[model samples]
Target: MKIAIIGAGNMGGSIARGLAKGSLIDDSDIIVSNPSAGKLEKLKKEFPGISVTNNNAEAATGADIVILAVKPWFIEPVMRELKLKSKQILISVAAGISFEELAHYVVAPEMAMFRLIPNTAISELESMTLVAARNTNDEQDKFILRLFSEMGTVMLIPEDKIAAATALASCGIAYVLKYVQA
Candidate 1:
């Protein structure tokens, strides 16, 4: 399956690295994009087989799945710029963005949109990623969970509890790290 990662930042980069290292996805099947060439260049150098580009549209085009790992502030703009396809599944890793908000941005009411909140542990393929969606079918849900399972444990939760889950699973990791450092 072709996967496009928009935003080669921490979360996006980690996901790409984990997917590549796990061999769950071939490097050639992944495309990573960022606004600047610096980050994309770094990823290309590190994961030579994965395609890297500065054009978000280019990265997202015709991919089976498109992951939005950009900062929260940039999500809307990126969505507006992306030429999203009906068959493509959209997953957002941005914190605080709701499924409804994402749906509005995509402008495809029937589009399957998922909210995935994974902690820094994703870099090590041990993240507690929370997945939530409103209208996704069982098969689609399973597919997403399987895709994320490559990185770490995945839990399907109610959309209403996404914030709490984010706090417990995402922020909770930082808290543990701080305690360990202390």
Candidate 2:
């Protein structure tokens, strides 16, 4: 399946790398986009097989899965700019962004959507991630679960619990690190 990651920052880059390393999908099947040409160049250098572009829409177009790895504040704008088909699954890694918000921005309340919270450990292929889906089928959910399994352990949770899960896993990683450092 084709996968497009709309941000090429730390999290987005890591997800692409982990997915490539795990062989979940061909590197060529993955497309990464960022506003920074330097970042796109860096990703291309690191994963020559993958496609890199500065055009978000180009990256997302025709992709089976579009992973929004942008900041929480950027999510809405990115969603608005992205022209995606309803059949494509939308997965957002923006913490604190709700499924309702995503649906509202995409203007497709019936669109299959997933909210994911993954820590930096995803870069090392060991992140504890939380996933919540709306209007998604069993096959789509399983496919997502399996694809993310390569990055780390994944749990399917309810939308209402995503915030708590994010606090415990996403932000909690920093708290754990502080203790480790201490």
Candidate 3:
């Protein structure tokens, strides 16, 4: 399966690197797109098998899964540009964006969508990733769970609980670290 990541920032880059180390998807099947070439170049150097492009649509085209890792402010514009198909699974790692907001941004509201809240620890392959699904079935859920499980522990939560889950798993990591230092 081809996975395209739109954003080469911390979360996106870490996910790409983590997936490259996993056995589920091959490095060659991963495509990363970013407006800036610097991060893309860095990722290409680290994982030569992966494809890097400046065009978001180019990376997303023909991809089975499109991960929107850009800043929340960019989500609407990016989604508008991609015009993602219903067959593609949309996973957004941006915090604070709900399923309703995401559905509004996309052309196809009925498409499978998920919100993933992964802590900063994802860079170390030890993130507590919280997942909230919409319009997805058992098979898709299992696939997503397995795919993310390769990076770290994954929990499937209800959309209503995403905020609470994010606080406990995502932001909680930083709080724990601060306490440790203190």
Per-candidate TM-score against the hidden true structure = 0.94, 0.95, 0.95
What are the lDDT figures for the candidates, one per model? 0.87, 0.88, 0.92
lDDT of 1 by residue, 1-182 (tens): 99999998899998888878765689999999988888888888988999988899998997999999989999889999996876888999999988878877875767888888887677688988889976688999998898788888999988899888888886876899899999
Candidate 3 RMSD computed on C-alpha atoms after optimal superposition onto the true structure: 1.2
Greater-lDDT candidate between 2 and 3: 3
Question: Which RMSD values do the candidates have, in order?
Answer: 1.4, 1.2, 1.2
State how far residue 71 of model 1 sits from its true place (Å).
1.1
lDDT tens string, model 2, 1-182?
99999998988988888887776799999999999898888878988999998889999998999999999999878988996788899999888888877888775678899988887678788988889999999999999999888899999999999878877886777899899999
Residue pairs with clashing backbones, model 2:
none
* Cand. 2 Cα-lDDT: 0.88
Best by lDDT: 3
The parts of candidate 1 lying over 4 Å away from their true place are none
